[model samples]
Target: MPTSQAIQVDNLSKRYGKDVQALAQVSFEVGRGELFGLIGPDGAGKTTLIRILATLLLADEGQATVNGWEVRKNYRKIRSHIGYMPGRFSLYQDLSVEENLRFFATIFGSTIEENYELIRDIYVQLEPFRERKAGKLSGGMKQKLALCCALIHKPVVLLLDEPTTGVDPVSRQEFWEMLQRLKEKDIAILVSTPYMDEASLCDRVALIQKGRLLSIDQPGKIVSAFDKPLLAIRTNDMYRLIHDLRAFEPGHSAFPFGEYVHLSLRQPIWPEAIHAYLAGKEHTGIEIKPAQATIEDAFMELMTREVM
Candidate 1:
């Protein structure tokens, strides 16, 4: 039989006030031991949804269940089986790394040694500086420590909200590696991130924006769904190229993507036309290259398709 869902949310909604709808009837299911992601930019209600699932906040409407326990009614039991690492570092600043880990383990009615294996690989990195105050640790070290404490109780479900944000590139890669190892232990994971590159690492992801669910599918499938031809054009006169490309076609959309401007041509446009336009403007060595659609490209299209 198919593994039962580790988490199920249906028609879930949350609002902070009359003006801000944090979540709008969002719905999805995370399978047991699956590494699911809520991918979106800032103020997209990711944190709001995570808080509600962690039992730190309540939804205004709809229903959710974590490991078969209703969120509204079985929060007590649910809390015991989950590990939550919020977007921000919320550990005791004054306490040492070891102290923070010990405190959290105690709060869950367990000890560090009892669940050492659960967080062993993560904790070892923090072991060298175990006596350092949490506030004094670097961004990467603090993140590792926070994760260790969250996992001290050997939770079945791990909820990490932007766990790699604000860390160095090396640290970010390491953090993802640790998460991959955790997946082998069959711990269900739900992580939220604004980084499009990280979406592919998830088994499945939901693209969200403005408190609404946009798309839900595997990363490759999401990229495959982007049915638009894109071209990357770059020239010595970067500013002029962007302007010319926009006016090249009546309905074309062009914007800078790193060193080049990625354009969605309204119809078939010749590379010579692109080169000629730039050449006429005294632009030099203009290069036009075919491009592939990425998650970010798909996200932009999904967000603006309704408006346009």
Candidate 2:
């Protein structure tokens, strides 16, 4: 057929009881050979959407398909062609690394020898611990082992839910590099994470918050679409900077970012104006500079509008 199958969702919705809406008519499509990221904070329905795609959870409304097979109609077929790695390390703790891989391969009616190349790169890193108990492995090793198990079946689509949530920085970087290599294999990869910085690594990202999608586009496009003047304000007293900036622009947006207070200006004003205003408040070491908008910044801007 095509290079690989696509994951499609249309007006997907999920709710818990009558109170919490886990997903609100979410819709998106992930093309083959593309790495699509669902970027959101905890409780933003990222996991729920990922679970639905993996056929582990059912949605209350709307339709979803993996590899053109509807989630409800042909779930077994879909499962056979897709690989899922949940946020947690779900491998058999008692099983050795090699045993775990073999177990998963046998369950899928395959063998490591049959699809060795698919996972060679990742598995090579874990080979030294082939006989080691999965639970005894380090976090990074555990992550690699789990990934090997997921890819042993040679799946056409890979679903990763918060794959790097608790991983160390270097391990996280390594894991992402593996994903990039896998993407080159024409596998449609859909990964969800709460880390905004990781959004830039994806081919496209969907910004979700509170079970609703805020924006969907390339990371660069999302940042560029924010056509507002962003400024970082720092002073000798960082705590008072936020209050002073808010007082200066009541209708504008001002929030703490790193060592400075980031302010989103609704109208253009020279940097000198802010210097004069903050100086009037008797603040020292005043530093005001234009800041670039990131995916996180764009998400915050959209969420702020949604609340107001």
Question: What are the runs in model 2 whose C-alpha is more than 4 Å off?
Answer: 1-5
Instruction: Identify the runs in model 1 with alpha carbons over 4 angstroms from their true place.
Output: 1-3
Query: After aligning candidate 2 to the native by TM-score, how far in Å is the CA of 211 from where it should be?
Result: 1.5
Q: In lDDT terms, how accurate is model 1?
A: 0.90
Clashing pairs in 1: none
lDDT of model 2, residue 162 = 89
TM-score of each: 0.95, 0.96
> C-alpha displacement of 257 in model 2, angstroms?
2.3
TM-score of 2: 0.96
lDDT of 2 by residue, 35-62 (tens): 9999999999998998998899999999
lDDT of 1 by residue, 157-200 (tens): 99999998888889988998898899899999999999888998
